[model samples]
Target: MLLNLPCTIAPRWRRLALMTLLLSGLGTSHVHAFVLDWSQVTWNTGSPSQTFSDVQGSGIDISISTTLAGGFYNTPTQDNNQNLNLFPDWYSNNGASSYIDVTIRFTRTVTNVSFSFEDMDRGNISGSRPTRYYWEDVIERANGWNGSSLVTPTATDVGSNILIDTTSRPGDVLYRGNTNLNWSPDGSFTLNWEQPVDTVSFRYSSGSRAQSNPAAQVIGISNISFHSAVPEAGTLWLGAFLLAALALRSIPRVPELLRIRTRSVSENS
Candidate 1:
């Protein structure tokens, strides 16, 4: 049942309508999560704070800030900044602990969100195996640790990926964090939440002792990835309608289409 229109659509508008509809459909159909590409992430060697927005073209911002210099970041070659490398960290001064927090936040709530804290181990580069004893951390819940249990997994306490404490540390209470597994080889320890989360952040301190000035420890955070919520079919259709409406609005009005006739007269006449 074709209904004839009183006025013909402009030729340019016909083409514009077709293109708008096509582009809108393509945008909605191809939405997927991309592992945040770090190739574009850039910062000075030791800038205490930085924020990289819309990473890998994803709707997320990855931020790092610290009290002391040399907080958290990749070396020229990304020595221990995520990407499965050992996560290098800041240190502890006890009263003046060098604290660093890497927070990944999405502007809108999203799902399938997950990332990891890699090489949650410690070192002095001194002993046979030294640990980040004064180190503590919390995931999403600051200062929420319950027990005070502390363990030095290695007798000499110098190694990578070793569990500092056996009990009360694994289940996520938040920490200045002395107790959590290293979770290396790409993800034995990860923050994989089944439900959606808008913000994912972890804070950690580093130092072999509390009284002395802060030193460097090692840790890593994996590439955060998540899928954007796909719009409903109804929503897509409505969007398409709006695009077509925009095209229609761009069409020339009836008065604008009118051509006024003009008569030419000679200047001498």
Candidate 2:
């Protein structure tokens, strides 16, 4: 009795088919998460020292002096000595200036972001009670990219007692969000951003309500999380093109493969 078998692909052909499948699966839906830290910061002059840098996986940098009048001090400390934190770094600002601005510049463009915040005073070390922290307004703003870096956005006080206002500044103001009231670190609050941003700035203490003494108020942040959206199909398209090119290059070898098969069949006969 004679038997017939269906045609089969060679090992190389099987590999090529697998590559095509993988290339098809590389869709544009991708996102990356980066936990903020002092190590990633490209520090400029007049920036604070690395005490905050001792906190691994989380940190924040504050400008000692800006075009505005206020200054900030940052140190690494856990909230109430608890595990819940946005980052280990905490800070306090004091000056005649109504608000203090903290800016975060990303190495990559980010479309979506979410971060947790606490407004308790570290001065109360018992961690059982909220300290004497007062605030009139808390605001956030984003600036567009000018090439690879963010353009310096202008920030003006909205009112007589207002702090830095990015809305009145030089660069394109892409997004804004704010909360009204005195913010303290007794608990945690998180902010999520829908607009894409290259740099993010947080305005603390608006409404002309600076600390009573401008020397007493303390503000603490636990951790910051950043999300980045992958660029549209450009990468996917490039991969698909490369795969198609490889498949075309293999076509010329197909005839050579058939000749070897034919020669094997003749020997069997």
Candidate 1 regions exceeding 4 Å error are: 1-31, 59-77, 80-98, 124-188, 207-215, 232-235, 238-269
What tens digits encode model 2's per-residue C-alpha lDDT throughout 1-269?
A: 01111123345567788888877767556665655443344334333222223122323222222222343334233344332222111122322254455555555456555554454222222223234333333444433342455433343222222233446445433222223223433233445554566556555443232233333343444345556555447878887787988787646366766766776677678
Clashes of each: 14, 14
Output candidate 2 Cα RMSD: 11.8
Where does candidate 2 stray beyond 4 Å? 1-22, 27-29, 37-68, 71-96, 120-137, 140-188, 209-215, 229-242, 245-269
RMSD of each: 13.8, 11.8
> Which consecutive 10 residues in model 2 have the weakest lDDT in total?
83-92
lDDT of 2: 0.42
TM-score of each: 0.47, 0.43
lDDT of 1: 0.46
